[model samples]
Target: MTEPTTHRTEVVVVGGGQAGLATSWHLVRDGVDHVVLEAHTLGHEWADTRWDNFTLVTPNWHCRLPGYEYDGPDPDGFMTRDEVVAWLAGYAPTFGPPVREHTRVTSLTERAEGGFRVEATGPDGPEVWEAGSVVVATGGYHVPIVPSWAPALDPSITQLHSADYRNAAQLPEGGVLVVGSGQSGAQIAEDLHLEGRTVHLALGDAPRVARFHRGRDCMTWLAEMGLYDTGVAQYPGGLAAREKTNHYVTGRDGGRDIDLRAFAAEGMRLYGMLEGGAGTELTFLPTLTAALDGADDVYRSICRDIDRYIDAQGIEAPPAAPYTAVWEPDTDPTSLDLAAAGISTVVWAIGYRPDYRWVGAGVFDGTGRPTHSRGVTALPGLYFLGLPWLHTWGSGRFLGIAADAEHVTGVITGRKGGARTEPAADLARRRSPGEIASDVALAG
Candidate 1:
């Protein structure tokens, strides 16, 4: 085996997706010397893993990269999977930092004196990196999570996660029972249903929002209403929005509602949460009505906000419509038989959990979540970014990552007040002529 290569830097950023690249941008702006390590190519998940018909749940306006906003012709529209991939890839060259692609970090061991020692395997071979600071930007969606009893599924039924699902042609000829009623589950169910497949969607307590209201998108109104400004630490009405399920909406069909109730109205069978399965029998909880009620509550709350925004701004906009989609009680078996229902596949669209096994002990909580405050961990020089509620309601989103990154860079560089104060000479040294041109060419 070849000897491990070693490099040193002021900061080492793990993962080269939106979060990592965003962090790198601020670091470059501050003239901090750092390198980005990506397990695959930049935006690997978006470029290679997403389904063929996959589009963003958020619109193009929310697809902002650090220091760059979307200025394309369709600012009000949504970006397809390919557009998202290209957007992220195009972001990196603007800063022109050295991104070590195809490099997978195996371990992050904190040095006794200070800083961290990052070990990885790259194209050539094993490599070692020592850095003053380490930013774990691998993102929250690291691993796929299925129920504990997923292995007990029928031998013949094919199992896959939403991350692995591509299209209807990839599965066997039969109905599909999709578990989890989050955005992914609802969208996948819709995709399968649109392809003429009988789909049974297991419902959870997910909220629904109208695709658009009045003359603007729901998200735009939310931003105007200051809903996106609500941080997890102090949400309005003491609501723990972090624990709440993502609102059920879709970017498909130029932004549309894709709630479970709507799916039920379209002939797709709706079931409760997937409790467990033995052999070919799957058990569901009696939570169908409760889930619908929860969605209705969220929908009403959003309409209330829209009404308040209209009155507050004194804008002459049309009245918002009420949510009318209602769930029909199904007579289907609570405990379903796969053979009887002709379900030859199960798609688990449940959310992901973080795994810090590679990270040295003492940085994570009992629940495997990293212990941090606005990306700053207890250990000095160790930080985290891209978590669902790391700082705010939009923490994991593309639009919110830059603020978190700026905060973390502030923590790293000790610039805690007043103006940025970054010297003009530092910027001139870091950004080349082409990079300067590219940065200026982006949306201001």
Candidate 2:
């Protein structure tokens, strides 16, 4: 959809990803006049930002984008990168959202007169749009975080953030040193390893989980257990859990546990947290064993939770088997010469930094995190949606966005002068049958 030079909308949502589109769907259904402004094409994050071999860690069934729930042939299977892109692209037209792609929001400020003033450069140069309320649905995982010490590495060795890493072929032919073992880092390491490349993994304390246990997807068990529905305020981590690194797992091929120990057993080099070094020398902490142990604890903790849930529900599932550590490190190497190790590339899978700087100053605290109660900000008429832990563990994921979108929309509808819906806290509080009342997104 095209926007005029000067335009007005009842609501303006900034972003065109699943989160933004989900909010747009709710607004459309409620008969709210709104426009969605996107910096890139819809689904560009899945298409461009992700690696070539990427598949969602979550199963296809969770790809519930408001009206567009996954009805694909294999709901339990993971969608390939192309499949995901197509699915997301197909979602917009189903509800006919007023989305202006490639229009980056440069600034958003609350107008003293009332409402909001949004400035952006679209296809037709600078454009100004006014709206009564604004929703920032640009989900977390924004800017790729590379350390300031990164420049100290040798010049010949290629450096790529996990965002820029498409495939092993993109890097020079040699061993690859992958730093950070979060979801992206672990998956990328596996991708490179599967391609028959020499992979050196720099481990962080990111937890790992099995894809399937007791003949069901872990997600399946968790969903039924209602772990995904955990609210931010109710979470043990409170809001800080939003900053926690996701567990390392995979839906690659069919889906399986990413056993870094297994990788080590297969002769892949493993190191501790990278501590940085100049020239070709790279130093590491002796955290590999501890990181590995910590990850195992989380894995076993999930198994225990599922076992307890099954027993409590009186469900006739198979007996749970304990996870035995496949391998253990004798001594973690503290340093390696990149040239000596034949590592020609370094993939920084550290993670992304949230960037809400374009939004007004009052929306954030000193730390720059947007402070709100389930997307409703302190300042009237402004909201946040699709942020990690905004409402629940599923809040930002495909598993939870539809309900969150609806809840945020409900809040907007009921704000002061307008009356279209009631307060939406209950929408988030809705529970599934037999779901553990105390179960959190976190297993422990």
Candidate 3:
């Protein structure tokens, strides 16, 4: 027999990661009744990620929630995957938000009246809960998408995606081929090489970052200068500037001391890598120019702000580092073919895209991402936080999530408008049993 549907508070938060947890924390602080539904144990998904030496590109200070600081030794240092997961697990209980672990939300349907009915399955069985709103904090990085060409690769050679890669232990003894030149790919190549694996890094036109300190930690400076807030909504130009600068870091003050050139110098081989679908061959010249052009305004602003701060403090600003490499792609045919030489395992670190099939219909754009004003969806009370480039360039990044969450919270509590709601009963009737069952099965 089908179990009776359960009714809960006004808001239901799906996913218990940093995004979801932060949303719940804010909801509770505002006295907004909410329940957080986690499909797996808190931080369990990270436990299964393959990269062993994974560290957030963004620093720790930015890794904060509404009321809590991410207290750790190295505020400027990036946290390891374990540290991040542990931090999230610890942060979840402090707010005491009701978190239903292992509860998988299969389908979310909007009630015509105004609310939502969330169909889920847990250890018990099929369960349904009604909420005035739903917040999909299930981040864009959960699923690892390897191209179809991966399986077609010669099975004899060892190949693994960055998601399934843990450490050098998993790589073949001969050499490693890290596909995709994003941060993850570079880091993995470095890690494997350090572990004594001959590493070949497939080079695409990747973004570059300057490794220097501007003033305080880069994140602290960003917060102080209001970069995160500036990129939100009203400031579309600032948002665009932020997005472009994020493509590659400008060499200036104290920042990370790692970059692609540094990685190459450390003995990581570079080869040509491109999106299998994009016919355009990877080149450094135009890509670098694009990156530099995009980041120029943001970097200048950061420098100007630093100067102002230094002047205010009556402290002499240090000399800037000599800018060395311009943004450029390697178009050398020889460099592109290095993979065929001896590279074995290829780690795809090309970044993540949102997968929103569970969100049902009428809410997403052609790209499968939720369509919202700030965080409020067309389906009333349904909200989203921590989506990549949601409104601005920084929306998906660590510092940006907080801003997005705050805006989302504001929208949900009636402090803001542009939201629609669905009645619980009407939402339930909209979903087919098959769709609900499929979602539940995946969550399980």
Lowest summed-lDDT stretch of 10 residues in model 3? 277-286
Evaluate all candidate structures by whole-model CA lDDT and list the values in order: 0.80, 0.83, 0.62
Residue-level lDDT for 165 in candidate 3: 80
Off by over 4 Å in 2: 1-4, 415-444
Ranking by lDDT: 2, 1, 3
Q: What is the lDDT of residue 8 in candidate 2?
A: 95
- Give the top-scoring candidate (TM-score): 2
**Cα RMSD for candidates in order:** 6.8, 5.1, 12.1
Winner by lDDT: 2
Tens digit of per-residue lDDT, candidate 2, span 1-444:
665488999999999888899889888887999999999988688888889999899878777777677877766678989999888889988989999998999899888899999999998888999999999988877889998999988899899999999998788899999999999999999999999999999998898887777756677778777778768777786888877778888988777789999999998899999998889998999998999999999999998888888889887665566778889999988999999989899999998878888886487877677888888898888888878888877878887888778778888887333322221223222334332222221122
Whose lDDT is higher: candidate 2's or candidate 3's? 2
| Candidate 1 local lDDT, 1-444, one digit each (tens) | 799999999999998888899889888888899999999988798867688888888767666666776767666567888888877777887888679999999999988878899999999999999999999998877789988888887789999999999999999999999888888888898899999999998887778877677656667667655555556778855435556778888888677777666667778888877788889998888888777777878878887888887898796666666767666675534789999999999999998888878898488877788888888998899999988878777788886787788889899998766233222123223333453333223212
Model 2, residue pairs in steric clash: none
What is the C-alpha local distance difference test score of candidate 3?
Answer: 0.62
Q: Can you write out model 3's per-residue Cα lDDT over 22-105, one digit (the tens) per residue?
A: 788778878888888999876676677636666676656566566666767655556777777787777766878788999999
**What does the lDDT read for residue 88 in candidate 1?**
77
